[model samples]
Target: MFRYLASASAMALMTNGPVFAQEHDHDHEDVTLYRVFVGDHADAKVTAFDLTEPDRRWTFDTTGQSKLYAVDNGSAVVAVQSNDDAVHFFTSGISLHAHGDHADIEVTEPAAIDQSLTGPRPFHVIDHDGKVVINFDRGGYAEIIDGHELSHGELESTQLKQARAHHGYAAPIGDLWVTSVASDAPVEGDAAPSRVGLQAINADGAPAGDVATCTGIHGEAFSGAFLATGCDEGVLTVSDGSDGPIMKMLEYPDDLPTGESTGTLLGSKSMQVFLGNYGAKGLVVIDPVDEPHFRYVELPFRRVDFVLDAANARFGYVLTEDGSLHQLDLLNAEVTKSAKITEPYSMDGDWNDPRPRLAMAGDEIVMSDPNAGLVRRISSESLEEVGTVEVEGQPYNIAVAGGSGVDHGAEADEHEHEAHDHAHSHDHDSKIYQGYFDDAQIAERQLSDWAGDWQSVYPLLQDGVLDPVMEHKAENGDQSAEEYRAYYEIGYKTDIDRITIEGDAVTFYQAGKPLAAQYASDGFEVLTYAKGNRGVRFIFEKTGGDEAAPRFIQFSDHAIAPQDAGHYHLYWGDDRAALLEEVTNWPTYYPSSLDGAQIVKEMIAH
Candidate 1:
């Protein structure tokens, strides 16, 4: 009878185990793990840990107080020592790179400081592309160094000086330098400059244009092609133009409460928006690209630390003083999910006290708990607690440095064949031609022949209208039939003076100064010519083909294509005589679908 009962129990258990078995199998699958790096100030050490593993991978002790910055897609980490007045770079040990369909991460021996930089009061460090810019507040100068040069022990550096240096910042973008402009007014009993201006320096170290003025200028952020500087009155927006950097002010809404401007701004990697702290308990989303540009989201408590989810363009993680992690949906501008990961840590203490900090490792969000001596990993997608690693001492500052890598074993044969094929292919050599025009009329005339858009060349005329030809007298007083065309065209002007293409990289120039530009996608490039608390972006795309002169379309912002088309187009080749004939017979040459005449009237009316 006992045997019979046992058989019946086994049968019943098997019938109900399918669901449990499926869940277990799903969780045990080979999931990609990301690595997290933490900087413990009190311990004077930096530690690395794998989120999926329980053991700590490695740790490095520093000379003094340390702040961590992960550069080159987590290939290395730079620790800025506050008291020591030096910065140290170390290999993260976890090497991550793309292969084909997937990514791979290699865990190697922990490396010591590969390079060291010494300066006075080195506070802010910025990584624009591979170049690192460190600002020495007390020293009143900034150092620009190349990351690749660190390994050769021959790093090239450029020193930038401020006007009257009082804890300011400076950055070098391409051939342009944007630095803080100190006020000339005398200090009144410990008060510094009430108003500061942003100054642009050209390649030759001369002023590019007039200083962009802003009162109480502070924090800075970059989105897409533009850089924004915050101020008491408004946000200063800067962009690259054909002539020089253009500065504009986006004033705060009249109905909004006063005394609430951000000094700390976080830029998004996927979207053209900025996340900033508003007041003490609120967060502001600044989207300069669209309508209702500024949106505020109120938090339950003051934010402890927050970071943009670079992998996910739509989400950001915010940790509040309540020890709760909230997922911010950038699209909806709301908190979509929340999870309590740690004990309550009040924000009422001194600013320098050890507090929780946030970092992202792939799809996982890592939060360092200084008081608990722990780092908790949570899944960004599900908002669930996944794992935790015990850390020694107070882990105040934290950064993550690993991503997905392709499996070598899975695609070894496929990659080898592709490599062999690429080795024998002929390479295409592309060159960039930059054109500068002092007058808009001449620029439009030049661009029209290349883009095949006669309407843009002559914005005031109708589709069937022809540019009038005038009879002129030559030097000998002989009558000569010459076409007299109006120079001024009705369109938004560009700040870009020239464009350059070297290999796959494309750069733009303004006032004979080169600005940093990146390929946004196929046939499109976004140029950042302005540098400072505020900067500018010029989006250009290649159109047409060998059948006609290749046309270049320049857009004011990133939004390109029809309905939301570009501001103008620049046509290649200077066939003025051919273009003149084509424009004269507009009905035969111009596209009937394009209502150029109506578009110009609407643009002018607006």
Candidate 2:
């Protein structure tokens, strides 16, 4: 079976399909999985695992203790080993491909890519658009690498330079790079110069616009269309404008006490809001559009770590020194839920000392407990400890990347064919449903609708017994006979040869062994295809099954209602939502009693 890898050539080939313009929201199955990467405080190693299956884990040895960043939308994780002056990339092996209406997901073994970035003190790693910029503090430049190329093991980068080295950051925005400017004065030893302001530079590293004053600018985040950076004066914001790059400062309200300023900012993906650290014991929710933008949330104790809920932007999570995990509501700027999860991790030690770090996995909050030597999972809604994964050393820095998406299985190549504008000709004629599917009378179906013994058609196609069927399709279809045969070779391939449905029980047979399960109707979904055709997936959830039996099974016949199924395509997986996302790898089956010639005749008749 061909596993989908996010390689350069594979990505290039994927772009050839037609973009899904519109999608109808309907009840569909989705498979959601997450991979979390954790950096040890004292060890030069990063551990990773699928949150649900922590027993099966992957580890990568780094040059020094590292800070992890989830980049390329979680397809890869960047390890910024500051003390070692080296940066490394690890493929999370979990990728989600969004197709306007739905997304396709592929999972493989996580491994270290060939590319590595080394310089003097690699500090900040920023991912924007589809590019990742790694800031080398003492090198006076940040290397901007394309996220796609990096996923494919490419090390090429464009350097965004400054006059002198400084503890600063730069982000790639459109055609220009917004970078921090350091003072021109010489520094002692490896110490960096103090930041003076921010400026936009062209691809050639020349100044693009006037430098905007941002004294002591340190932290930055992206909220909607705006990029906000922290400064002593206020929050420096930048956005792409018709004239050029628009840079402005949102000054802090005068009513705030002295020595109170936000240094770290977390932006919401679902809303245009920024959550920044206000002093030691307060969190500020900044609204860019409204006046009196700052909404301060007072905590019971000093903050240990905080993270924004990117999936559900309504809430944020904060861990205080009292070991309490508080859920912050962004809209109201209030602490909604709180629970003590770990032992008190005082804020009295060094900034880089072992402590809890926060990361989001779907709607759940994943926090690292260094003293406990464990990574804990807490429900965002209940604020309760749901699970934990043990680590050997102090789990310091952490990041998570994974989401719900459909797995198209081996039909990865078939999706590339969809990018074109060719009309897909089906063996069955469009007699019942025509034009827009909005008028189609779709409804839920019973297991009895497709009952009885069914045999996979893969062997017939492989043995050239289905050559006449391919020839018949080419005569009435858009593709050639050879092309249709090759496409079917992938689409109809399957290990399970026979499936028997009796009452609520279904049995799948491979070779001679049978795995039976009891199934219940889970509902159905009508999907609009890229070719303007629509099909229905009648879903079933396993009520009781053998250990190896799939948790979910869905059938796609040409029927949309209570008609008996003749031949159908079947999809089964543990993740119901993910199985619905799969648009390819449909293993088709016909009546087991039908001979090769009879099946060919039935195909031509359809």
Candidate 3:
């Protein structure tokens, strides 16, 4: 059985027609099954596999040679749209169409036309809540296709267009999409564009007559209560919704000296939002709900583009031109963390160089690493390295399956722990404080002040908490799940470290001794800066719950362990990593002292 790993070769081979068998190493009723539907940068071929299962492989080449990007609308079906003006549907069912049949090749149905749209140059396609929406740039129009199978095999499209042609999008509701249309007159040069706005289009192509226009409106996002619109002057705030879905344009509000911004990102967690840099080197957050002022949040590097953390809901990731995934915090709108992804794709070249694009498949995030030729998985929760898999030539888009078929049993178990514990903590008498801290963070912030990054990134942080000891457990059995280089292990009891065994879990560093116990999984790096020695370590601890006896958390610091090691961590980062592990509902914050003990005890009593 083949498990996806992170590497250059893996990225190169991500899109091809070959089924594979992947192993499952868990004690459960079912097996780990996954099928990744990948589209190439150059080739018109579409790759499919049971990402979780990896037991078989499938491939379907698009009828027309168009660049394809896909979004999973649940089940094993994917909605794919290429540069060409059409949307295709591909399924992973074993039944095969004739080899000569490009349209019939394993297709449950024929290709769906973007009838709602008039002009070509198809832009983007998104499947929100089973509604398939297609965007056309040539003509400022969008079409919607429902995911449900109708009695007839023919596919239908719904039309929704703006008054003028401009570049924009449809709001989340799938009804009213925010878009841009052509200006009234021509510009100084061929560079066209006049005004942009939030146009409410009904299901049948008709503008609601109410348009909240922004001069340079480009990108936007809408929650039920508020809508963030990006433009030149600043974020245009429109809180005056007569009723129904509120619409407002938040002009560029950050204090940057660059040009203008249209790329606006909205977080699902704290209602915070982000705006890409004017020229691409900067980003900012405008929390109109909290701080109405446009705040310029600096970034480590300028981004080619950025993606919202759908699974994580709180944080988002940016793929820089330098080939790195910088972890972003939407609540605060800042670059919180970063990790290298590839050896850097040539930015000096053309716009369509088959560079890696960032996408989330379940909790696993797949980046098309052209130089690395591999797609790696970063723990959405821990934001640490977990595992990776190889793919073919410049994987442009990735559509994952089976994760829906079988929710990450292990990953879900981890989330269940937080959900149940969170409710329990709220009821607990604990003072309700922030959770844990990193080495650099520990110096400036107290352990009890873990909020945004500290809490959501590591569930140990929250609004209110009592005497709380946020501990993580990891274990290693004879058969390890992923194989890679370097790992972390729970080692000996040192003068500063205390190791205790309470049942199956080997609790280490009770009072925060390791400085940063971030890597609580097998074979992690310590990153000893003062000493400047890079090595590796191995550790194994068991889960601390009754539901499953062998549950544990391990740590492998690259500086202290051997290379070629890997493990699955999905509970902490941005919930985009593919390392879906088996999880259980356990306590996230365990009381080890009196401060929050009474609260927890009170919660336990109920």
Q: Pick the candidate with the highest lDDT.
A: 2
Alpha-carbon runs more than 4 Å astray in model 1: 1-33, 54-56, 94-107, 150-155, 187-195, 203-206, 407-415, 418-606
Q: Estimate each model's TM-score.
A: 0.63, 0.66, 0.53
Q: Candidate 1, residues 1-606: lDDT per residue as tens digits?
A: 000111111111111011110100111212244567788857778887776774847888786768888754455677888678887777766543321111233456546665577887787776654567777766767887765444223456777766665556665543577766777888787565554777787644467767788777777765555567777777776665566566777777765567788677787644567887777787877776565667788999988888887655578889898889999988788999998888988889787688989987756788888888888888888878888788988887988765543223322222111111112221111101011112221111122211222223242232223222111111111112221121111111234434444333344445655544333222323222111010111233333223332222222211122221222233222342222111101111122234544333322221
Q: Candidates 1 and 3: which is better by lDDT?
A: 1
Instruction: Give the lowest summed-lDDT range of ten residues in model 2.
Output: 16-25
Q: After superposition, how far is residue 392 of candidate 3 from its true place, in Å?
A: 2.6
Tens digits of per-residue lDDT, candidate 3, 280-383, equal: 56666556555454666565556655665543445677777777778777656567878776666655677666677665654556665655656666665555
TM-score of model 2 vs. true structure = 0.66
| Model 1: ten consecutive residues of lowest lDDT | 16-25
Model 3 residue runs over 4 Å out of place are 1-34, 52-55, 63-73, 76-82, 91-119, 150-154, 172-179, 186-195, 222-224, 236-245, 264-278, 361-363, 380-385, 401-606
- Best-to-worst order by TM-score is 2, 1, 3
lDDT of 1 at 271: 57
* lDDT of predicted model 2: 0.75
Candidate number with the higher TM-score (1 or 3): 1
